[model samples]
Target: MAVALSRRTVAKNALSQLGTFALSGGSKAIAAIMVARTLGPKGMGTFSLSWTLAGTLAFVAVLGLDNRLIRELARTRDPRELERSLPLACLLGLIFGGLLTGIPALTGVHSDAAQALAAAGGFVAVSAPILIFRATFHAREKMEYETVTCVVEGAVALIAVAVALGAGFGVGGAMLGLTAGRVANLILCLVLYRRLWGPVRIEIAARRWLGLIHEGWPLAVSYSLTATFLRFDILVLAIFHPSAEVGMYGAASVILLTAPLVAVSFSSSLYPILAQAEGLDDEHLQSVFQKTSRILIVAALPLATGLTVLATPIAEMLFGSDFGHTGRYLALLAWILPFRFVNHLFGVVLAATHRARSRRLAAVALALIANLALNLMLIPTWGAYGAVAATIATELVIAGLLLAGIRPLRPILARPLVEGALVALAMTGVVLVTPGGIFPQLATGGASFAGGLWVLFLWLPSRGLAAFSATEQESAAAA
Candidate 1:
């Protein structure tokens, strides 16, 4: 009965995550379209660059302690210890946030509105506590609380941006609104976490603090470096290209990247389960990885295929005709989703399994080398497309290297690869027949996806797909 309840909990959590992503992703996409129209490419570019910088700084502020908190608190099952770690993590987050925000100001990059940037930085600095508190919820596996926090945060951010735009604040207004939303989220998360975790008794030990830092510092370094690689291209473009170009690239990237929400949702739902399962023997670990990989591939393939085949029409419908070229870039980027999805899953597995150091090293090295090479080779020729190419190349390298490092994960890779190819073929057939209109393209894509899923379901060994269905009592019993 407990096992049945646990399975149900996992399923419920997974569904909630999917719901949250659907809401958040839809809201964000709508917001991006509105912002793109309001600011054009240059304004969008500036916003994207600022966001990239802010996100990088946010990762720094986290110092990788978020995951540490989850692991330690989950393992220790000690609420008192978890409560104690919160303020310390927040302190570190503030210091890092201050440095991140201050560096740009001191360098005269924000020459026109240094005060506003500084204020923004301070707002971000205060955000660390919110982030740490949020991690505490994840540690306790309180998916409902986590989901509520995410949905509320996203909804607030979207509404705030719309209001800011309507009020004629433009890009800066949007950023301020975003910062405000984060602050709101931080406050809400703290209140909810306290209520959920019960009254907090704050205590700290130097040894415990150092232990978390020691475990998390490498992850922090890995996260920071990996973040740099992910966002460095935008920074490069901001330096070399016009803000309009940056905006164009940024807008298109946002649209293309939206597809990964499905993959991310799956990973987020499963990571805790995997973390708990880590104590099991090797055979059980491998079984979990295999089943998880199959589920991930099954979900990712059709989504990627649909995006690739319908990229142009989807882009136009979402962002308007003004963004036609951006649509083309989105199309090209669709191809990377399968690879990115695989990378995301394996990367989580690596981190959860304590191989994060090696994964981080490979990721950083690949990102640096790929960014330099791609920027030099493609940027002058392809502009934003060049950046996309660079991103794809870098992600592939990181995924490839990480897979090499974690040999145990290799056996699970075959099904996803095959499934992806089959879905691509089916999507190609649908695209060839579908006409130009938006509704027609969407219908065609939807039909293709449904048909492809049916075919794959019929063809793949039943054992592989069975693990995904929580209601299959017999299969559950077998597992």
Candidate 2:
């Protein structure tokens, strides 16, 4: 019962994180739509490229230390470690922030791209330290601070973007809005830090900092590669195609990419629990891993199905008519959601099992190389469609690699995947037949999938959803 309750607690925290992502992603999604509609394809393309550049560099600013910091804090509960890391992150932020600003200025791109990059530079500078604060909350399982900041940031972003677009500030203004939101989020996080952790410490030692970097460099490499590969297609697109085509791909990719955050939220909540786990072979760890895989499949399938079915209308409604092919791009990319979600779990599991340094890095390196090769080959011929193809193919390859490498997690996927597919197919039928807008289709699809799961798995004893809990309870009793 205690173990069951603990699992429930993990689920609760996961929900809180998911809620944070939902609100934050919602605001950003709206902001994206506003940018797309107001700016059209050319302007939207500039904004997308500029934002991706900032985000990719922000990974460098943190030195890929966020996850490692979380795991360490979860294990050690050391405040001094947190204090040391905060200043380091801020200092790196300032340095990388300069790089973000300088590159576009030096290259002499369009004024809009330059302004967007400059604003994004400010964003990186202000936002780097927030990562430390967020890791602290995540490791401690105190997500309410995150929740508060997410809401405030999202609201601020929406208002700022709306005001910018209203003022005809263009791509630069949209970028500034994003930076403004991050600034607010950073300030709020600082206040929360003081209130919860008591005071701010700003001491840094070079030797200790280098030691931390030494420990984190490998993870940094993996993370940077991961970030770059994910957005490399955009860079390629910008090179070979016009901004309008890039915008179409960007508009589609943004919506589909946000779906992975759901998996990240659940995995974040699970990480702390998994850190305390005995080993990869531990009974509780195995049970929870299987259960998590099941839950992610169940959550992701309906979303992927709905998006694939409604991609065209969603694209038309969100970005207006200028983005003619945006819906087709989204429809193709929607299939990646399930694979991406499960890959996120594979990563967390690898980290928890202490194999992240080698296996995970290898997997990401392979995928990154593949992505680059595929993009180079596909982009010139297929344009934006080529980028979509590369993304889907890369996800599938990486998912296979991760699944094959993580032996314990392999068997857990088959059942959940089979069940999820059936439910998704049923939901798709309902969605197709239902004669209404996207909202009604969404509602009915969700209802049918939910009803199908309950009836098939919960109501019927033959195919119970409680198998893991039952196994865990029995194991506990036996012990």
Candidate 3:
């Protein structure tokens, strides 16, 4: 019963996180579309550049502490420790914000772009502490709090961006709207934290701060490298190509990147569970890892396949006639989903197993080096396509290396993978013939895919996802 309950808890948390992403992420997607359509390609390019810069810096400011904090807090949910960490995170945010603000001025980009980038600096500052609050909730396994905060942030940002665009504030106004949403997010996080765990006193515990940084720096390097490789392509492309072209890629990215939140939400839900299972043997850990990986693989395959097949329609529908070519980029970028989705679990497994700074760092570091070299060589000639190639290659490299590093815990389910591909192919065939508009095409595609999965289950009752059904039961029995 405890085993079933634990599995159910994991599912519940994963579902809640997915629901949160669907709500908040959906709003953000709509806002991106609004910005793209209103600003057009050139303006959208500037917006993308500014966001990539600001978002990358904000990630760096995290100092790799979020995961460590989660693990620590899970071990000891002491408010005093949190009190020390909160102030440090905020200070780091302010520092990174300053750095982000300074870059645009130094680089001497256009005035409008500079202004937008400067505005985004404020986003970094407000967004920093929110991570800490999220870590707090994640540790306690009360994901509903994080869900509430994220939903409010997404909604607030969407409305603020809409109003700003309506007022014709342009790119700078869009940044302000995003900043406003994050500010609201910060406020809500504090309110929720205080209501649940009581108010935390902010103190300048300098020594502890240094120790925390010292402990987290290795993870920070790994995280920073990951962030840099993932986003630095845009910065490189912006340097080589025109803003209009950059905007085109950015539009596709708005969807391609956002799609991974499904993987992220599920991974976040499972991380704490893995952390709590620290003393479990390798066999049990392997079972848990394999089960979760199978789940993500099954979910990601159809999404990637569907998007690849319908890229043009989806892009044309959301971004409109202006970004029609974004479909081409989306088509290619969709293939990265399977690798990216599975990669999320690799990091969680490594970190939860206390190998956070092991070969995982080496893998990411090598990937970053490859990413930079590829971007420099390709972007100068192939432009945005070069960046896309680099990003996809990087994800594949990381996934392959990390999977190898985990050893004896192969999570790739062979039968499901083959079966999933077959189902996706069938779904693609249906989607092509039964189409009036994007909506109908999507509906038909979804139904066909569901039907395919059901038919497969009926014929092969003990195959695919069901084959691993006993993983958790065995673990529970062992415990």
Candidate 4:
């Protein structure tokens, strides 16, 4: 009965994650399209500047409390710990939100645009504290609560933005909607947390909070690096180019970055299991790491292929000709999908193993340094295209470094790396040959690739191209 309940809970959590992504991805797409269609490139760029900075600031304020709470609570849920975290988190969040709203000049946007950017940035900070509650639900594996809250947030943002646009509120209006949505999201999450974990309180103890901060500081550094990498290209581009160029980059980015959302969801679902498996034997742990790496690599191939093939039509359809360059940017950026997939698996492994913190941090830190230097070298000459180049290169190097840290992972990566590349190549060929609108193209491309890969693996066993296979049950057991 315990095992049965565990399996059922895992299934529910996976479904809940998928639902959350659907809500988040869909809302973001709606918001992006609306911004592109209404505000044009320059306007979108201004918004992105504010929004990105705000995210960075919020990360600063949260101090990695979300992950820390989840990790500790997953170990053992103590009411005293929960009570302490609630107030500490709120206090830190308020401080961070104030910093975000207080500083407008940091974005380098000028005049009226700068003002709009400041408002957006402030709102983003205001919304970030809700993650503490979300993490609590995650630790308990009651993702259904967070999923509902996410949907409510997205729905509220969309309605707010639509209403604001109709009323001619422009960039500032859309930002206000996002901020308002965050409030609603926080309220819902807080209510749910109370239902499951009880009411919030403030019983702060300096020593305890300090200890919590010490425990989470590494996470803070790690998350900041990760978040910065995601937005670094744009931040650098804004420095070297016009708002319109930044907008175009932002447009492609909104879609390109969504590729990792699915991978993240998968890794996130596996995280608790892996964390709990720390005491397992070496053979079992090795098996877990190897299988997870393979799964993510294989999953990334078709996605990267399909998205790359569809980039042009999707970009044009979504943003029109003013943003035609976004397609090429996306195509070039598509390869990062596989690299990012591998890196996420590495991250979960690192987090689970618990000894890889310094190594992981060093690898990402090096990647960031390299990313910035490359952007400086390339962005001036190539603009948005340069940013894409930096992105692909940085992720590739980061994944390679992390893989090197996990000595046992090389062999696992070796076979799938070749297989995934070959599969993606086959997928690319099919997509190129079967030319049509989105649906027909996707259908033909997907079928042909799936059929071709199926045949290749089956008939050419000597080629060592046997498909990596794992049932969900097998993967769960390995974890």
Candidate 5:
């Protein structure tokens, strides 16, 4: 009964995470379209660069403490202990945020006053506390609460940006509104957390800090390296290429990258569940891992293939003809989805098994190698296309290396790879036979994609979605 209840809890959390992704991704797509139209490529490029830098800074500020806290609190189940630790986490974040902002300012990376880099920096600093508080909700498994907060935050950010733009604030105004909305979200999250968990005790202990750091530092290093590799292309483009090129690449990246969000949502929800289930036998753990891998692969493959086939029309429809070139990039990026999804599953498995150091080492080595090789090989010759190729190559390497680390997950990944190839073949055939027009292509392509999914789901007995049923087979397996 306890096991059943835990499984249900995890499922519910996964659903909530999926909801958050859907709402946030939808809102962000709309917001990006509007922002691009208003600011044009140059302004969009400027904003993208600033936001990227801010994200990197924010990452450094948190230093993986939130992840460490979640893992620890999952074991301890002591609300009071978590409460006491929250403020300390927030303080550490703020200090880190301040340092991130101050260093950038001193270096003159953000020289223009109109750009409001300082204001953005301040917002990033305050955001640390908000993130710490939010992490507490996850630690407690109050995922419904987390979902609601995510929805509200996304909605607020979207509405605020629209209003700010309408009020004639341009990009600067948009930034201000986004910052304000984030602050509001932080406050609300803190209030709700306090109400539900009681006033968290504020305590700072060297031992506690050291413990978290020991666990978190590897993750932080891994994340930083990975992020740098993934994001440096934009910075490179902003310097070497035109704002228009950056805009096109950014647009394509935004759409193509949405494929991974589903995988991420599933993995995020699965991690804590897997961690808690560590007491289970190795066979059980392997079984669960295999099941989850199958589901992720099955889901991610069809979407990626469909997107790849329909990349041109979709890009045009989403961003207008101003982004015609984006389709090619989107198509190129589509191949990385299956690899990334499988890689993410292995990563989660490693982290949940407390093998983060090994995972971090693998990630760092790949990131470093990919960054240097890709930048040298791609950026100089092919421009954005080169960058896209570099990205695909890097992700493939990362995925390959991570898979090498997890021998158990390899067989599970093979089934999905086969399914993905089948789906891609179907999509290619449809694209070839369909008429040239966008609508015709879309209609035939959509039908073919749906058909492929139906076949895959019916024919392939994935263990992940098997939980959705309670038939004779599952009963037999359980017994």
Candidate 6:
């Protein structure tokens, strides 16, 4: 029964986080479209490159301490130790992040782009501490706090970007707006955190912080590699192509990534719960892991199908005629959703087992290197389409590696995957024939896959509760 409560908490938090991601994604789309349209492809390309660089450097600033703290907090309820370590994490982040984030922006790039990126990098430095604070809420499975903060951040950023562009600030102005939004996010997080745990009396805590860094370094490396894997293509494309082409690619990439963001939010909601079980109770962890994998796989199918089918229309509608070929890139990149979703799930499972550091470090390193190499190889010749191909190929290889590594999940995943594929195939058929416009096609495809899955997984086990609840309980009992 206690376990059941935890399971419900995870579900509830997952939903909240889903909403957060939706809001964030919507805001990102609006910002990108406006910025890209205003600045043209070349200008947009520069902004995107700087933004990607900031993100990559932000991960470097964290050194993976957030995950370690969250896992530690989830496994226990000791506030004193964590309280001491968190401030240390934030201070360290600020120290490293300030130097790393500012140096390149001031020295590495040109004038307008440099100023914009430097500000954004400063935002990342401010934002890294927020990750540590937010993880406290996450450990307790109280995602609404994080959700609210994201909403505020996104809302501020959207308004700022719109206002900046309207004022003729262009991409650089929009970047500044983004920085302002992060400042808002940081303040909000600190206030909320203060309420949750009172004032932060952070006294060095050298040994503990160092220990966390040692433990978390693997995840931090994994994170940087993964982000680079996704963002590298655009940087590569920018190098080989013009700004307009980069803008078009950016347009496609934004929409293509929304689904993966959902997957990541879902997995993050489950992280603390799974961390609680890890080596202590394999059965519960395995069962929940399997269930999560199935849901994501099923969800990914219709998403991939719909995007593949309607990419062109949606691209044109959202980005305008300026990005004519956006749909083509989207169609090619749509395959990444299903693969990325499953890959994210497996990555979570690995983290839960506490072997994520070494395992993921190696796998993600290979993936990052592979993505970079492919982008270099493909983008020069094929342009954006080649970049898309590189993305699809890189994710496929990573997914393959993840599958091979998680042998225990094979029997568990086989049936659900096949069922998901068949359902997706059927859904895709309906979408292909439905005609009408984007909405109709999307509605038909989504309904078909979801309705089908509901029927397939509707039966309850022994608890006599609903199927979903029963499954969770049964899985918990197995532990």
Best by TM-score: 2
How do these models rank on lDDT, best leading? 2, 3, 6, 4, 5, 1
lDDT of 5 by residue, 1-479 (tens): 01332567767878887776666566556666776777766656666666556656666666776666677777776775565456666776677656545754577664432354555675577667766676677777776776776677777878888998888776656666667667767777877887877875767665677766676777667666766776777778777888788878888777755668778778778766666654323565677777778877876777777777788888888777778788998988888887778777777777666644565467657766876688767876788898898888888778777777765445455767787678767876887788777788778877877777777776444654565575767788989
Q: How far in Å is the alpha carbon of 273 misplaced in model 4?
A: 1.8
- Can you tell me which runs of candidate 5 are displaced by over 4 Å? 1-7, 99-116, 206-208, 277-281, 424-455, 458-479
Question: What are the per-model numbers of colliding residue pairs?
Answer: 4, 0, 0, 0, 0, 3
Q: How accurate is candidate 6 locally (lDDT)?
A: 0.76
List lDDT for all candidates, in order: 0.69, 0.83, 0.82, 0.75, 0.70, 0.76
Two-way lDDT contest, 5 vs 6, winner = 6
> For model 2, what is the alpha-carbon lDDT of residue 328?
91
Per-residue CA lDDT of candidate 6, range 1-479, in tens? 02442667877988888877787666766788788777766676777776777666766677777787788877776566556666766676677656645765457755666666666666667767788888787777778888888899898998999999899877668877877777788889888877876776566667676777778888888887888888898888878888778878888888876767778888878787777654523677667777788878877776787788888888877777667788888988888898889888878777766754477678888888888889999999999888988999999989878776665665256766787778878898898899788888878877887777776666323325566687899999999
Clash pairs detected, candidate 1: 41-244, 42-243, 42-244, 45-247
Model 3 lDDT per residue over 267-359, tens place: 878777777654324556767777778767776788898998889889888988889879999999999998888887887777676654566
In model 2, which runs have C-alpha deviations exceeding 4 angstroms? 1-5, 108-110, 456-479
**Cα-based TM-score, every candidate:** 0.85, 0.92, 0.91, 0.87, 0.86, 0.88
**Tens digit of lDDT per residue, candidate 4, span 283-337?**
5556656666776787678778777878888787888778888898888888888
At residue 264, candidate 4 shows an lDDT of: 76
Task: List, residue by residue over 1-479, the lDDT tens digit for candidate 1.
Answer: 01122567667767767766676566656666777888777667767776676667876776778877776676676777566667677777678667656865578775323333554565567667766776677677776776677677777888888998899877666767677767777877878977977766667666678777777887677667777777777877777778777877777777765778877777776666566554323455567567767766766767766776667777667766666677677777776777777777776776666544565556666666776788777776767877888988887787777777667556466776787677767776776787777687677777877777776655555756666565587777988
In terms of lDDT, which candidate is strongest? 2
Candidate 2 local lDDT, residue 435? 86
